[model samples]
Target: MLYVFLSICCSVIVSILLKLARRYSIDISQAITWNYSMAILLTWLFFKPQFQNLQAAPIGIYTAVGLLLPLVFWIMASSVRVAGIVRTDVAQRLSLFIPLLASFLVFGEALTPLKIAGIIVGFAAILCSIPWQKKTANRKVISNAWMYLVVVFFGFGAIDILFKKVAAFREIPYTTSLFFIYSLAFIIALTGLLIRVFNRKARIVWPHIMFGLILGVANFGNILFYLRAHKALASNPSAVFSAMNIGVITVGTLVGVFVFNERLSLVNKIGIGLAIVAIILITLSQH
Candidate 1:
């Protein structure tokens, strides 16, 4: 449970840093590029993963995750900036519904009654969490923050599915696969950064590098601690799953509302509650 607590902190801290990036004028692209560098370094240092099984690795899934990670990360950053932490986190946590749906629709798994109920509630939660911009007298509604939230919801869910695919591939050790995926992701991110620099749309700023290093630590810590929690609670996988999702939403809401003073509509509040209930149902269905 301690690992779960730390993981929750790291997850929310990542969002807080992303929220702060806007105020600091940080180039999220550059920061995200450098973030993979740190992740690569830590993965190698901590896991000491072997690359001898590269030929057996699932390159297709690796490539997909490599492409999506930075893109979704930037979108999540934009979401935190525009939509506020409360709604963005709720949307993210509810994304678990995607994999559950995939089990039924794509993998031919039977859907239990609880899963069906959870899916219904989870869909409602997503709709409620959308940060709908109110119409002004001039009707000049400018914020498309809800779009970012919607993208984040689906994007992370896709990433999660890819990760599960990687995990199921037994030819390569999971840590080694992770190391290779991070390497590929770093290359992809670096390529995008170079293109931006070439186009004169961005520069190699020092602040982004520093912030990226810190963000990478928090991001990696979230993964590390969550894995630790699962390993420690191997007999009860549902506990880890439910605790992580519920914890992030709970902690993120408190920080967003109290520390950042983020305001949520009554409907959004209802969405957050439904999100928790949906996760509970999903976890129960697994049992």
Candidate 2:
């Protein structure tokens, strides 16, 4: 239970940090680049993933996740920037639908009634969650936001599937795989940063580094405690997954509305309500 709480808190804090970064004009790309330095250090210290273990791990999967990670972070940053925390969080939570859809199509997994209902409701949640308005300019803002949200939806889902594939290799330690993923992602980001510096498009800043370090710690804690929750509830993975997603959406909505004063119309509220229901249904269907 503590693990669950910590995991949810850490996840929400990452979003909160990103929200604040925008307000303070933090360069998210640079922050994200430095974020991996902290994350890798933490992973190495705690997980102690050995160098010898890497030879057996799948390099292709690591590369894929590595590339996808930085790309998705940029998309998510865009999501939080343009869409607000509430919509971004809900869009991410509802991304569970992507893997389920892939499972049915690619893996030939059978869909039960609960799953069908969950899928329908999940799409509803997406449609309703967008910060849509009646005015043309506002609608255009939301319309562009939907594009970012959709990329977030599928981008994260693909990343999720890639991680699962790495996990399926029983011989490969999860920590070792994560270290490689972050390492490769760091390389990619560093390269991009150097290019930007050469073109005079970006420059280093102390505040962004500070924010990145904080975000990295929060990001590491998010995964660490979530894994701990799985260990605590070994008999029920579904519970861990369901609780984490629902908790983020539920609490994220509160913070966005109350603390940040991000507006959510009536339909958006209803959509969030259905998202909770959809998560439960999806979890039940798994069992």
Candidate 3:
């Protein structure tokens, strides 16, 4: 339970730091690039993942996750900027449904009554959380705002599926696979940063490095604590899963509304409520 609480705090802190990035003139690309460096360091130091027989690893999944990680991360940052933390957090937390969708449609898993109900309610939650008709310069800009939210929804969902694939690959230890993925992600992010710098679109600065390191710490802590929570509750996996998804949305909502004064529509509030109910149903279905 303590691990769950710490993981929730770390997750929300990452969102808060990203929210503050543009305001503080931080270069997000550079910061994200450096973030992987810190993650790699932590992985090496704490996990001590050994790189034995890389040939046996699922290189295809590793490369795909490496490509998608930084890309989806950037999209998430954009979503937070456009959609606010509340909606973005809800969409992310609710991404667990993606794997379930895959299981039913692709893997031929049994779809019980509770799973069906959870999916139905989860769909409604997504529709309500989205800003369908908001005032902007034009309809396109309005669409663009909610578009980030939608992409964040599906993008994170797809990433979740890919991560499950990676986790299932028992050829290598999960920690070793994670280290490889993080290393590839760093290489990809650094390539983009260097290109931007060469094109005079960005520069290497100390502030971005500092912020990136801090962001890395929060990001790594989220994974570390969540894994710890799972290990601590190995007999009751449902508790950790439910607590993590629900906790992030709950804490993020409080911080988003109170600290940042983010506004939410009446429908959006209802959607958040439904999202929580949907998660509860889904967790119960597992039991």
Error of 2 at 208 (Å): 1.2
Q: Sort by lDDT, best first.
A: 1, 3, 2
Per the 3 Å backbone cut-off, how many clashing residue pairs does candidate 2 have? 0
lDDT of 2 at 224: 93
lDDT of 2 at 287: 86
TM, every model? 0.96, 0.95, 0.97
C-alpha lDDT values of all predictions: 0.91, 0.89, 0.90
**Residue by residue across 75-100, what tens digits does model 3's lDDT show?**
89988877889989998888888888
lDDT of 2 by residue, 1-287 (tens): 88999999998998998888878999999999988888999999989986775568798999999999988988898888778899899999898898889899999999899999999999999999886663253443445777888898889999988888888887778888899899999999889988998999999889988888899999999999999999999999999989999999999989999999787889999989999999999999988
Estimate candidate 2's alpha-carbon lDDT, on a 0 to 1 scale: 0.89
Q: Which of 1 and 2 is the better model by TM-score?
A: 1
The C-alpha stretches of model 3 lying farther than 4 A from their native spots are 135-143
Error of 2 at 266 (Å): 1.1
Clashes of each: 0, 0, 0
